[model samples]
Target: MQANQSRKTGVLLVNLGTPDSPEVPDVRKYLREFLMDERVIDIPFPNRWALVNLIIAPFRAPKSAKVYKELWEERGSPLKFYGEDIEKMLQAHLGDRYFVKLAMRYQNPGIPEGLAAFQKAGLSKIVVVPFFPQYASATTGSVYQKVMDVVSGWQTIPEITFTNTFFDHPKFVEHFATAARKYIAERPYDYFLFSYHGVPERQIRKGDVSGHTCQFGACCETLRADNRLCYRAQCFETTRLLARELGLKEGTYSTAFQSRLGKDPWIQPYTEDMVKKLAAEGKKNVLAFSPAFVADCLETTIEVGEEYKEVFEANGGSHWQLVESLNNSPLYVELLADLIHQRES
Candidate 1:
């Protein structure tokens, strides 16, 4: 009884890391670490190594740095700061029985550092919550594997749990819907766009252990037992939940994938193409939602909010509004607490 009462749980919240600074060198370093991951590029090690080092990192880093500079805020990258803010907030909300820590999977205050803190605190259990709403090999899966690799060396391993995916969580859906409601109330939007970070088509096929692979069609319309871990399916399910909450009609809303890299075929229709399609269809006012990310990182603030806006406007769309993410909303904190409590049971 005393042992149970004395045990303290540790919560480690992880987000995809950002460059320490939005400089060429820093961005290059960040990209090297990120793209080199097997789960991310998912190619032969020798090929992945050569591609990221020789071509992509050397050339793409400078361009990426410029964009990161645009996305940078006074305090620093919003992704990093928001994770910091949420760490303190969740710690306060959980009180003395739990210790909350923040980690970036690829950079400073990394997974190793977070786990070391839990080790020093002598925590009896650890719960990992990756910030990605939808499960993807490059994001959530990478974080899970990283945590395991680090913990495997520890002489004394504690109980560890992961909140793999929460795309269907009631609060998760409500948070996005509530954010969009504020925008909808402002004016009429001709269409609603739900954009998610794109993953390779091959990766989607790799996850289909059930043998019925992704055909990249209406198969993603609903979640099922076979495509349960499918990133595209989870993304579509997220769109459905948010649309239901906002009372958006069928024709008025659609889902697309964004941030695709390389020439390889990724899940479609691409967000950029979708924007062009909307403009061609005479949809002047569009409301875009990025539910794949829970925080307003580069993907949301810069890409979807800024870059996509450029695409829409250039293609003849008049008004484009981006529904911001649930950065530090009280409701989001509650959702995290709920996940932690669910594991505690």
Candidate 2:
């Protein structure tokens, strides 16, 4: 292969995905595809299939569809809309040197379509940037695997590179801090909550190359070489970096995980529990941040913003405000552009 003899490179930006519509059937189809992934459920094929088809998809789809309805804007899913905007902004920022395309890992504009654009552009090098800020087997890992599966059959495969994680990137931290500052100046918050998406404890332990090191204690307190790919550790590291940037003190802020499924144990101090605890402790006002999500999706907008707010108020808290996700923000677009340039250089 002659490397396509082109100076251009391809940037494929992938996000978790959204249902094409809020209808039950569409949500069910999306859930079936998403929950069936082995990396996500982390179970045997038969068990995973049974869980998705027989139990989860059938039961959760209608309820999840309602939530998606609440999240949908006039232009449709905020996740998809912001993703498209970010792709366009990033393309403009990178200019003629890069061909940028966006994809949703599960639904419309999937991995195959994104890679096909790169192939059509005759670009010899492709960069796969999973939208996940933290490296997780279920999210970023799955995206990388799907990208390879799509490109493996090509006669002349491009030089594909993957970004495993960028949780502690300075610009990423700065963007969140700046967003939080905008809210802080407007109102007084008694505490700050950093809520990240939850995964099973087993998932974290499974990714531990250094066996038995990812125990729920000091093991994940710092970002060490052994725990480099541990998702929980990276989430905590993100919280720490953002807290420092926002000039937050130790007791003033806390970290929690959200959106857990199944009966299995998930990474803790769960978000729901944290909200109740804060209310019980007489913390009347709190500012919540979901740094794990770059776009304002169901999790950030409905889960933390609406559902959690209700929980806090019902439990006796007066105010619960969620700091918005970095949805197509200028800083966020610049951050993505910087990452692309670094990878290309």
> For residues 41-131, could you state the per-residue lDDT of candidate 1 as single tens digits?
9999999999999999999999999999999999999888888889889988988788888999998879998999888778889999999
Per-model TM-score, in order, reads 0.97, 0.97
What TM-score does candidate 1 get on C-alpha atoms?
0.97
Give per-residue lDDT, candidate 2, residue 265: 96
Clashing pairs in 1: none
Model 1 Cα shift for residue 61 (angstroms)? 1.1
Top candidate on lDDT is 1
lDDT of 1: 0.91
lDDT of each: 0.91, 0.89
Those runs of model 1 whose alpha carbons end farther than 4 Å from true positions after fitting are 1-7
